[model samples]
Target: MLRHFAHPKRLTLVAVPLAVLVAVAVTPQVRGQQGAGAFESSDEVRAAIARAERASKRADRRAQSLERAAGQAEQEAEKIASQSAALAARIQETEAEIAVGKGQLQLIARQQRALDARLGERREPLIRLTGALQNFSRRPLVLSVFRPGSIRESMYLRAVLETTIPQVRGRTAALRAEIDKSRALRAEAEGVLRKLAEEEDRLSLRRTQLAAIETRKRLAARRRGGEADRQEERALAYAEQARDLDGLVDRIDAAGALRDELAELPGPILRPTRPSQARASGTTTRIPPSTSRTVRSPSGLRLPVDGRTLRGFGSVDSKGARSEGLLIRAGAGAQVVTPAPGRVAFSGPFRGYDRIVIIEHPNGWTSLITGLARSDVNVGDTLAEGAPLGVAPPDGGAIGFELRLGGRSANPLDHLSR
Candidate 1:
């Protein structure tokens, strides 16, 4: 099972990386939700930002409209104030006109009373004149016709009686017309006052409408204010997330730098046979200690580290072959060793090698040392066989080990002791 996971075949290699990324992305969400407010996905956060922006735009438009409305209302109110003032002035004028009409009516009443008293005092004289005139003339005082003292006297008296009767009738008609005119003027003044009252009522209704409009605008503003506050809160949360992401990126960058330095160091070398050790006679050895060890060649290679074969070298994929570098199942934090004496080629984190080192040999061979618990070497570092690459695990575990020639992979077993 361990070998199945560690083998760097097409399926294993591709699947494992995807798995790691997914795991990393998912686990954090679960943990965060338990403590923090619901962890928002990137999509969710982005959507919230968009929503806030949209709402802000809408609020801006609404605020502008409200402001315009308020301005218009103010202008209308001012106009109404002017109209109200005009109406008030008109009412005052009507009242003044009504006072004048009352004065005229009072004057007419006084004149009527004076005329009645004068007529009453002259009643006896009028009756006597009427009686005398009735006998001789059709009008109330035909004195010339009644006297007939002389032709000239009779002509003069007849003229006087005719002119006096016509004059008196004209005076009475003129007084009645004046009284009627005064009453009509008083009625017209009352009608003007009634019209002014109606106009005041209309203005009052308009003021009420203006008040309603103001109230509606205020309510809309408050609703928008609450929405704005929520948007701000959402924005703040997103900003905080952005800040956290920046810090994480920085840490990842630091980790990457450390990896690069480690990649350049030489790794451990594997000798096919110990110089003093000899095999027993007549025993078949699975492997002779003379095979090529280099990844490209048949000899000259080294073991990356001292550990059991956690996984063997070969393509294990059932699908098409996809080759990847090896995975050493070393204990976490185990020191990875150099394979042979060589110049450090690379010391960095590759997509497959979390912390890795590559060394270039004098011969066209290269070694990949990965699964490092921690790295002790840096780029451009020189190293030899059995050098202290780093500390190893107390309980041994496999180290991710690979060898390449020129740039192609070679079997690790070819380079080890039989």
Candidate 2:
């Protein structure tokens, strides 16, 4: 019986399958024995999972926020005169969605790689076990009795097979589960890709719409003649004369104040037709109250662009120069809108600040925005609150917004609507 058990063919058939099963069962133990230097610990795995969950949550929140902002901008566009703002908002929303989709695809890819690694860990062992099992099944039981072990040895082999077979089955079940998870991840990646394509399509549509609206506006401005040109020339002159940004703001403020004063002046008085009729009228002449529009505070003003503030009002920069306005880091080609109802005092390039816009609001309030790649509105264009002023630089550049009351810089955040 010992000689039969030691036969090369019998040993290979029994030993190979048994060794494969043993390897599969003790893989975790072997890995643990290898120490943390060789493999990740349980704590490390849990931390990685936690970070992935946090990133997914943040992506979800950002997508929701962009959706809400897009809806709000669409409503505002319907109420305002300019449709470019809404189109720009839509384009931004689509870009954000596409970005989120790409991120999700990357995450799915990571999960697939992990699953592949896990499957690889058991793949060779499972294949060996399967081949050995097939060989044993193909051989006749009566032939095995004639060629190898005695009845006692045969019974011992049968007992080992009973134990090992069940373990192999369990391991295979776990592998199937992992494979199913991998399939699900692949499906999820496909879904994200489809969404990304849809978003790209929508972005293209919005860009086309915005271009058409901008073209119409330009044509209308041109038809209005040299008045806007003259105003822009005057604003350029002011920009040239001013030594610094503050000086330019002061000059614009003074000009606005003078304009308001001239508008408020009374027209020539008219004489009454009859002296008796004039006498019958009240002797006391009552002056009408000024009807000029004004905002007492910036409490209800919208932010010029949707972004995070890189530098707040009064913050010092690398140059040790205090910030007079908010330095916002916005997405590529983000829409810039008027914060309040105002007239365009200056809209064009100034110095090295790229394209800039200065909006003159009522009651000595002024808004200055800089770092635009393009300016939609010209000088002397009257705009309602939330009207499209322009777009930020295409490469996700930073833009500056300064709010001044009576020629003094103020924190825009302090008065923004909650």
Tens-digit per-residue lDDT, 1-418, candidate 2? 4455445555455555455455444333111110223213444434433543443343345335544555566554332343554555455455555545544555565566676688788788767766766676566556656755555556676557666655665766777677667667766766776776887787778778777877776787788899989998999999999998789989999898878777767787688777566654346544433234454765347667765568989999888999998998766777677877789999988889999999988777899999999888989987754567888888878989999987788888777754
Tens-digit per-residue lDDT, 1-418, candidate 1: 3343223442332333233333322321111111122223434334433443443343334334434444555555433323322232222223223323333333333444444454445444444554554454333233444655744654565556555655545444444444455445446545544654664565455445544543443354456546544533433343344344223223333333334446544566455477567555685434322123332442334454332344567756568644334555432223344565665545544444345565666545556676555555544445543333443344534466766553456777776532
Which prediction has the highest lDDT against the true structure?
Answer: 2
Clashing pairs in 2: none
TM-score of each: 0.27, 0.64
lDDT of each: 0.43, 0.69
Scored by TM-score, the top model is 2
List the candidate 1 regions with Cα displacement exceeding 4 Å.
1-300, 317-326, 391-398
lDDT of 1: 0.43
Lowest-lDDT window of 10 residues in candidate 1? 27-36
RMSD of 2: 9.7
